[model samples]
Target: MAPPTTGRLSALLRRCASAGALSPGAQLHAQALVAWRLPDVTLETDLVLFYCRCGALPHARQVFDTMTPSPSMHAYNVLLAASPPSAALGLLSRLLAAGLRPDRYAIPAALRACAELRDALLGAALHGFAVRLGLFSNVVVSGALLGMYAKAEVLDDAVRVFDEMPEKDTVVWNCMVTGYARAGRAKDALDLFWKAQVEAVNMVRDVRAVPSVLNICAKEGELMKGREIHGRMVRILAFDRDVAVGNALVDMYAKCGRVDGARAVFAGMKERNVVSWSTLISCYGVHGRGQEALRVYKEMVSQGVKPNCVTFTSILSSCSHSGLVTDGQRIFESMSKVYSVEPAADHYACMVDLMGRAGAIEEAVGFIRKMPMEPSASVWGALLSACAMHNNVDVGEIAAYRLFELEEGNASNYVTLCGIYDAAGRSDDVAGLRSRMRELGMVKTPGCSWVDVKGRACAFYQGSVPRYLRRRIVWVLDRLLEDMGGSESEDGHTNIYYDYELIRP
Candidate 1:
């Protein structure tokens, strides 16, 4: 039952390739020279592929160069595809100049390479080649071409290619949608989604399709539109929930100020992932419900959902808003010990804010010194705000000076420093900082807040609001206390102090 020597070597080489035993494979290749003979072109190609797969590019090239005959089109394509995208263009060009006819398999990768390089010229040439070779009918190759052109920001050409596609699949549509959105054409992308919905009822119901359009809607703040899309999704994917879709839904509602709706969707899901928890927790943080956000974090832990970097950011933000210093510290330490999540600059900023809010300026300073990374402007800004709150002129000066060093033109740093100095009655210091800010060409960003009232909305700037609305506010407050149950004070100030014995009189 002894096998022939030539077949035996081939089988051994294939086995090595299968098992990914690169060293043993090389040794076997060496043994083949003595034990059997030089392997056939097919076996040699397999060995080259095995080496390439094992990341032994040098050995693969050595095998390739020594091929008994020049390698076939397939061989060139494999090596070209395996090389890094940026470097692969040269290898592919060499293959083309050598008069090798790139087959259907080769075109997709070439298009992918062009996409990675953002080389629209090469990608267009490949697309034309695909058309001439009649491989343009293939969905995957066409999709790659669309994605490549989109990556290069050649949207018109990408769209032309897409329209020419006789059979557009979901992937092709998805690429165009994502491409348009990434190119900052949210309106155009949404129009495409609508077109897809009208043209293909099945695509509208597709889960992947839903998430892409929903993402666009989320970014554009089109809440009412997002609501309609969510309704359709609920009807279609009722029993089948996708984590991505749920996350997007949570984010959309949270961004639009419907935290309750977001929470409801989150609660109704039978399966909750880490993003889901993070989204809901962040919503609470944004809405100033730090306690509720903290509770959600604890609940996520109880359910064994691991926290990631984003999760820690949300947790720290919650602590900062609620002024929960002890809770923030406990969670920050546990990030490494329990959750195994490394703290990043964002987490450090939150920690500084938490400490600063609690008037623990010295502790915050000490914590910043121990940070594993350099303090970013955001971290310094938080500390400066805290110093302003606590009237700590000394530390405020230090933080402001550091901030000025980091970013000389940051007007907020100067404003915050001036606030601290002004509160301390350091008029000259305030004037100096303002002059310095002006010299640096730093202009203060205006502060504005939006208030919704009785089906109408208005925004108030730092120095002005609509005159009628301001008058109405005063009139309402004046009326609310006009008939109050109180005895007039004998002196100038109104006195509402309660004395039990006086009540008996």
Candidate 2:
């Protein structure tokens, strides 16, 4: 969110506020009061929040002091929310001592502070305060309490808080769902979603939480479940009115390897925005359909829905994946010239990947050199991967060493560089790299894979084989080692990154 701007005074005030230039800020405050006859609570509160963000709490209090004469509950909420955890609770105490009752806004802000601090004692006390004020049923206040307990990693307490609530809404459901997701309790989160569906607890009117459900189904490759939700939306509500739900469907169908389904959903959308176009382009990109993604992008431009940063990233990635170098370059160059969209780091990384994947290693290096900003790890990693593909040991070393500084603990960098050296028959260099890795206690990262079977999510971790696959694994165990160019260890597995690929939908 951006800070609110007031005509001419806000720009200067925003700068002074962010820089903690108290003298200049005071001047702006005086100018604001003189310029506008009515007191601008928004500008005053903005100054307080900016000051708090800059860690100039004393100056924030000075703004607060001026506000106290004609204070707004919104102003109090903004200040407390912006404040550091301990300081927020202290300010709440000061307000309570002055015989001022905390409103719903104030309670949530204070509870948020408790969440950040993980101060259970004060959290419980604030819960009592909220109860005394009869705000226990207030959705905002109850959501905050749930969030506070969840942040402390106390799901039991969070669930207890949820159960005791006399009312629940989309916000409460989302919080509980997010809490379960964060705690690695995906089953619990899914169960909660199903329970809410069965009870029809606001699901009929509020489809806000549907995207999260679709996201989970997509991640687990549960195409069946995603289709069920899509059907439910069609039957129970006018879901086509919202763009977000449509985007989620496109994403779900795309990740489930049902590109036609995604396209069909896109075609049937009654309303479309930039995000919808971007999601369609990304869906194509993921399935290695660069030409189709480019077609969609061109169609988006033709329809006057200008591409945003995300759209460019998706299209550029599609080009990279399918080796559409010419299209990728033209688009990257046009990003600033025609569209006025500044190429951010992701865009630059995509360019490098495009050139590198096309075996234009020198062009990729040149692109990095010409980048306005410092090359990110993605940029260098793209170069490194290309180097590995073309067996360009010299350039690979350069990218690898740069990555070493950028991501020190990533064992994959060392592994890639070592692979390059080994391929070049540089025995001494390989020994030296191995010795360095030993000195640094570096080891390869383990891999894991899993798939969804019906409604259940089955996970396979590193160094473990599924019992059902034991026979197949034994048959290929030796041949797999030979293909990977690594000798098998005593445990019947090669020294390779093995297991589950990330289930991104």
Candidate 3:
């Protein structure tokens, strides 16, 4: 009940930090201060760590800064680990200025801040510093450096660090995969996942790779490979026991156009969280199963799994896809009033799309005008897309004007506005817009599509097909058109989505 001595008080502070008992920890500090019983460095470190763990940064800093000889480097580590990027880097500077070399813990924490800030120069400097201090040999330090480079989009440096590491562990592997993903190298991520599995044949299989691998499979729509990975996960390990793996499985199945599979995985999971429910709802929403998504949302609420912001976004997106105007309106109203979840930009954008798609363009505009915050680019883009769909040239022009201000370099906005004018027979306006786009050096990006053939995923972009494929694919298409008794205009044209050829190897 009482901290009778310094040693006992230090232990109690650690216990409070572990339990995140902020109130009791604060009272103990007050008692220490009033009694003029200043704690030793270890006790001071414990006090700072206690407050940091409890998210009381102000209190942590106060105790840390007031130390007679300054706090230990370890004390600075605790604060930096919990502080924001700017604050963490500031503390790291203080550590350097104090002329104390940072240990493995402080280095990784500082590297994490660099990754978040995307400060590649500082991260590279830290990498050099770690090498000089001999922490470069530490597996954790290597992994942190790899993660920092990956997050900064410097994949070459990340890969070099990853390859040079004497011992590769799950942490570094996940970091590499996620780095590839964040850098838009989805195929590279999948290749690394495959490579890791091959290497793990002689070592311990890392179940941690499942989520990242599954996500890559989802993005690529490689259902066959995803299923194969699922089998391996089940046989080599009991991966279903891990909630994160289960959630990724659901997401992967859903993203790859298998709602039934996603639903089955959700049903089989022994544990569920807000993410589990939200992922299912999102898959259903994405697939235009608005009614099912709504049912799931109701079930989630009834089961006392309070809907989070993601749940609302998924459900609102569902209504937008299905044109469920009334349901969307009810849910949007309830977000702030009943649920106390303020509508984010995403939610506001979804509402505009919902109303605009349902042929209530005027109402959607009015909603945008009365929004609590300034309309984001997404909100205006949604309105512009809807106007293009409905051939509302005047409203389309207004939305396009706002979008040009918001995203001056976005070619899609210009293309959509040009389409609206073309649809309304405004040839002069279309020509002028085309001229403007050309002057701005804004060429429309080619559409890309992925094809999965016998476990191999191939990506093809418009107008970038091989000459052999184009000829053979056109010939095959012409034959199919002749067989189907198709119209003359449709014959001999490659499918717009892809210029695919089905030649046997």
lDDT of 1 by residue, 213-318 (tens): 6777666667877898888878887423677888888888888767777888898787778999999999999777788999999999998989999999998998
Leading candidate by TM-score:
3
lDDT of 2 by residue, 4-72 (tens): 247556567668766877777776766666666235676777677667766777877877878735556
CA-lDDT, candidates in order:
0.81, 0.82, 0.87
List runs of model 3 lying over 4 Å from the truth.
Answer: 1-39, 53-55, 73-82, 198-205, 236-239, 453-505
Better lDDT candidate (1, 3): 3
Error of 2 at 242 (Å): 1.4
Task: State candidate 1's TM-score.
Answer: 0.78
Order candidates by lDDT, high to low.
3, 2, 1
lDDT of 2: 0.82
lDDT of 1: 0.81
Per-residue accuracy of model 3 over 77-181 as CA lDDT, tens digit each: 889899999999999999999998889999999999999999999999999999999899899899999999998899999999988998877788778888887
- Please list the residue runs of candidate 2 whose C-alpha ends up more than 4 Å from where it truly belongs after superposition: 1-94, 103-105, 112-125, 131-140, 148-156, 182-184, 454-505
In model 2, how large is the Cα lDDT of residue 21? Answer: 77
